[model samples]
Target: MPRNRPLAAVLTTVVLATLTAAVTTAVTTAPVAAGTAGPKTVIANLFEWNWPSVGAECGASLGPRGYGYVQVSPPQEHVRGQEWWVAYQPVSYRIESRKGTRAQFQSMVIACHAAGVKVIVDAVVNHMANTDKSGPGWAGSAWTHYDYPGTYQVQDFHHCGRNGNDDIVNYNDRYEVQNCELANLADLDTGAAYVRDRLAGYLNDLLSLGVDGFRMDASKHMPAADIAALRSRLSRPVYIVQEVIYGAGEPIGPLEYTGNGDVHEFRYGKDLARVFRDERLAYLNNFGEGWGYIPSNVANVFVDNHDTQRDVPGTLTYRDNGIYALANAFMLAWPYGSPTVMSSYEFTDRNQGPPSDSAGRTNNSTCYSGGWRCEHRWPVIANMVGFRNAVAGTGVVNWYDNGWQHIAFGRGSAGYISINDEDFAVTGRSYRTNMPAGRYCDVIHGEKSGSGCTGPVVTVDSGGWFRADIAAHDAVAIHAGARIS
Candidate 1:
């Protein structure tokens, strides 16, 4: 298990003061490229967002909400198309795509860094574009099927063919899964030194532009050795969480790539979704390893990703506003793996792009307008970000549940939360907390302004308890950071 790192300047609280004096210092602010993550650290995946809009969001919301990093869409040149999948296909390593130009990409990095937020780009090194798609791509770079000008040649890609069309049809075979074409997209032969060098150069260029890490696309298709080789060439290890979706019976597993970095845990989302939607609140008392998931430090957990929201059945999404917010609140409040909040725009079709102007350029997102759901901006979810940060490094404490509808817990003395998931409401229920006697703002209901709370206030007595009556499908959350007096 990875130990939680202490913050540089700890929050000036009685508990934090003692934690600070533990004396053995740890990692912070040096880019979360690779290591066991701290509890306070959370990254938000801003899928399909362009540069200017992302920069604005970094300044307006992300940094203030305590997000340590933002994983953006692939910024390299890709097929000049509107569909979201176009980003996963590459035309060249040139930092030019629908998101923005190289200059705009650099500017966005600078802007995010100014707000103390790091940028982790979605690095699609697994494949080039399909042969059917001829490319004078988004940045006007002309290319043929296997020839990327000034970089990869036809020899750089694998020609493995088990199926007649060279597509990967056998998931059970390791060789076929790694070397064959995925969805008929051109697969790169990542093992060759020439191929490794070109891939490393592309990532190193991003590093020069102040990128902190990468979300390795199709990492399951590439050997762990190939990724480790690519990382060895870099000056230092950067955060690299691979997209390797493996369950109980998969041939290849996430352990294969842990040497390189972390993997975005798909199982974590599926497990939580089942209990929350079914209103099985009792099973959650033992929510972490008992439910079968990766450990807290190594796993990058989320409630839903861009793909799962559209394709995966029974997964909670922004459409399920009441239920989805409830799940997100649970994910944040629980001391599980390092969490990633999904901040995405709304889409009816699976292939729809962001809201665009007449010229097909992505319009600046107004979030609530322009089809952007912007769940990160929701008051309940936004305030929970601070709640999670304040309670960093603390274990779950004072766990209380009514065996069905209501469940309440504390994070040492830093925070406390009670969730009511049943159809009926509960009134004036006394709940135990670990916090000292004081009135705290329930951040999920509203924010604490100046000396007043915009939400309901909970006053914990000298004995560390409070009485709160929450409605069905509602939650109550309070932390020491928001204590008004």
Candidate 2:
């Protein structure tokens, strides 16, 4: 069903020489930042994999790929059900849940750490367990409406009702948001002394197990003051990323959490997806600013996340877009935000459990197997992982675009990339690629062969400019240090 196009004739040797010369001149003369660390790109959206499955799948696959970190599923105790939402219901601070036992979770943390991949746990501390009439949770912990046995009780929650619903409805009212139930899930009072200590203890426990940071869910529902206080008590330097989904005009936004850690750049993902998939090429040149973007360094960008993929109406479907693969390639190639790539299993319904058998047991399905769809392993997507690591910390320079179909750019002379999304061939293009004189690999199309690239070797001459022709619906990336000039 998928067809690969041939290299365009316009990408001739003569044009490449000219572009390479221009690129070199620009880079060599530009002023450099003192001791500036190059881009550190991290690609992870560790989907619905429970703890054991994460260890089994991510530990071995992501580490050697040079990923800076892996975003894991929530490790707290959750409700017991055949549906996926059960995990969103937090009953206790125990590491034990349906994903795996405590030992399996710890093993995954250790394994990922050993492989050079930092682990960021999804923390649902904004609330306690849901008040469902169901008995106990997956961890066998008894739970009441706002009471968590042996952990916390309803007295720890703020007693407030809005329109006959006990849940907090006032977003403008910060107090209610932090103390009210989210989707009927029991809300915890982070300001409470005992609650703060218990949460800190839970976080400290995760830190002891080698967790690098956290993804705070339902963060918009928590008060900024309380969150900062809690963050102060936790292990310093934790990679804290808060989920404050602010789109268009929702009032509450990500700005409140910037002091705590990096906030999810939800708007960036939507804008980029639109420009890359539906809009014209002219819109992409100002990619960040064109959409009222955030500072690239702090934004956590992704094409489509678990929640949006499932709930957003009329949005781009992941299955329809071979575009997802292309989007990820562009994200990795571009030095924009701290990128996160989603790794998900196939499901018929939005609420269906992950790759599980009839008994509701999570199973490790192999590639081409019926249940799991490991998009991360796709050749195009997997290869970009290496590309991101190779050019980490480099700023975008020598940017070029051909109409709305093709885009080419370089990252601090460390790497250069070209992408073509049109159906027709592109020709006569020379752009500056500030890398030194050397032969480099086009990673998108070629695998690393020995010390140099085996196919599509981009040679930067004594000058900086080079001619580049990209086939329709194709992408090519050239990185430094891979070949001899």
Q: Highest TM-score among the candidates is held by which one?
A: 1
Q: Scored by Cα lDDT, where does model 2 land?
A: 0.69
Position 233, candidate 2: lDDT: 80
User: How well is each residue in 1-485 modelled by candidate 2, as lDDT tens digits?
Assistant: 12333433443332223122222221111111110123435657667676665665554566545566788878788877777777787888888876777888899887777656688988887787665646577677887777778888878876667647777676666656666677777778887889888888888899988888988888888777777877878875688888988745656677767887788888767766566656654456666644566666577888777777675443443453355666778877776778888777666798887776675556654543555556655545656777777677777888877666678888887888778777665666766888887676766655465665545777677787667677655667777634435
Off by over 4 Å in 1: 1-40
The whole-model lDDT of each prediction reads 0.79, 0.69
Once model 1 is optimally superposed onto the true structure by TM-score, how far is the C-alpha of residue 115 displaced, in angstroms?
Answer: 0.9
